[model samples]
Target: MKEISCALRFMFSAEFWAMGLCWTVSLLASYWQLVLRRITGRCEVYPRSELPRNLPTRPVCIVTGATSGLGAAAASALSKEGFSVVLVGLSSELLSEAMEEIRKRNKDAHLKGFVVDLSSFCSILEFKSSLEKWLTDSDMHSSIQLLINNAGILATSVRPTPEGYDQMMGTNYIGAFFLTKLLLPLLKTSPVGSRIVNVTSFTHRAVFDAQINEDIVTGKCFFRSKEYPYARVYQYSKLCLLLFTYELHRQLNLDNKPWQVSVLAADPGMVKTNIMQEVPFSLSNIAYLVFRVLGLLQSPENGINSILDAALAPSHVSGAYFFGGEGRTLRSSALSYNTRLGEKLWNISSNMFFDLKLASQATSSSS
Candidate 1:
């Protein structure tokens, strides 16, 4: 009994350990900025009044996974800021409820709900079609100035999406990729500078242990392999997301591209949300409790401030990484800044997108 108890107490917790390490690193990563902000009492988020005077009369913001948690909080806040917020989620009912909740906050909130299952390529394509049609009908298609890829999940067990990819990676990274690419054209057309904010995680730094060579990122090695633990897989997905952010930033900021589009990644710190509902109950509960006691767990509204900082950032900070309450722009993991790796990942991901589109078309023709 004593031995069993001792082992149980010492049972390895990958998530807890990863989160703890991430917490320490993120603090050190942004510690100076945090102190500077405290001393200067500086705020980074641009209030509506500070937005460029030539803003589209109806600037639009699309937030994925807007039905709950950090996504929902961000959608609500954006709507209240007078942007025509498009709420994207997997469930129609929940999306409606989220829009209603946001409306309750601001009766005049301009909100539209679109059902999008980020795990399914077909579903995301359908959302793009529907969104474009609505924007055209409303005459606001070119007004889409912000895209927040905030939908993510942490499954306790391995699961495959309809496309035979890991569900967590699909929903967190792949789906966001498809959605952003499909909408990039509209964003590029915005007269106002457009911004794309990817909701990354602090655990993204945990991927340092995993060699980030071409094979690992290109999915020839570990990705989609069920051999890894769920927590590790989640970290991998976030790392890919951070890579995508940097890669997209480089692509859009090229001299040839005649549009002002900035790409940023934000780490929301430790927000207690339903995204971790499927985690081992006992372990997650204890971890959250400890963090709560330490005042490390923030609410969704507070957690989303980093994301908001990215959305509201000026056009100059294109490749910034917003973190913590101060919304200080900080450096991401060293691996994230590997231009060669990010370029390779981007090329592979773009090719995969084309391949998936061809396959989807073939299936349609056969039917």
Candidate 2:
């Protein structure tokens, strides 16, 4: 009886110790987050009143994922600044509503919406052609000055697109890659310098153990041959964008092209967006509520500030990442910048397009 009593006592002691450690860790994390928010608040990094006066009479800004979240907010703000806004998204209903909202705020803003799902290469091709036709049709082919790659997806379960690429990677990287390439000429033709804002994330720090494996392009499976974790996949996608942003900036600046091309990345910093609400994970509900209590977390308004800042800033600081709309350092994984990996990713992406060359041919012929 004494032995059993001692065993029960030992078990109770272990449980108490475990509970204590958990609470301690949670408290420390909360404190750290609070400190981070305080530090970020002191950084006044947004370009609030610094819009250039020499802006063209018909300056244009293209904002993807403008149907919702920071994309919608940024597009609306740019329209108020008198930009001819081109909004891209997959939903016509949401697009229409967003257009109406922008018009209400800026009656003179030339607002247009195009429906394009960033998940499919074919749809992206169509969207590219549509943008080209619109530009040619309107004679403003040289006026597009800003391209904001803001559209993204966060799925609970890993699903492959019709193109055999992971859905997250397809929408976030491949579509964005093609869209930026197609719009290069238009950006080059801007009267003033042109800017490209790639909306990446702080979550990219989580990619310490990952790489841009060829499976991201050709293989029909993900790691573990099961549904990929949404957070992990999203982080990988952002890492790819981050690497591309750096590489593209280096190449463009090296050439010293006619137009001063600057590429900057922005992280909205835990914004109140529907992406979190739509994440299919079981713990996502608790995570959402916790973020809600954090005072430093971003609203959609705050989220747009960084994107707009990168787009409108006069001084070109190319190839830098911005968090919360100001210049910030990234704690990226070393593997993310591995030249060999970046080259591999680029080659895979290039080949994917080449493999589907026939579909592209059909698209151009139809166009």
Best by TM-score: 1
The parts of candidate 1 lying over 4 Å away from their true place are: 1-49, 52-56, 209-227, 257-259, 365-367
**lDDT, residue 232, model 1:** 69
Weakest lDDT window of 10 consecutive positions for candidate 2: 15-24
Encode model 2's per-residue lDDT on 1-367: one tens digit a residue.
6645644543455433442244234334434544576687643243444455586456778999999999999999998887888999888999999999888978887988999887787787777778878877887745577899999977646677777777888888887887887678778877777788899876666566655667754324564565345556677788888888877776787775622778887767677677755433333444545666755457898877767767776556677566545433333446656767667777777777766767778777999
Model 2 / residue 251 / CA error / Å: 1.2
Candidate 1 residue-wise lDDT, 186-273, digit = tens: 8888887888899998777766754554444433344556444666677788888988898888778775753388888988988888
lDDT of 1 at 124: 85
lDDT of 1 at 357: 89
Note the Cα lDDT for every prediction shown.
0.78, 0.71
The per-residue C-alpha lDDT of model 1 at residue 206 equals 67
Worst 10 residues of 1 by lDDT: 43-52
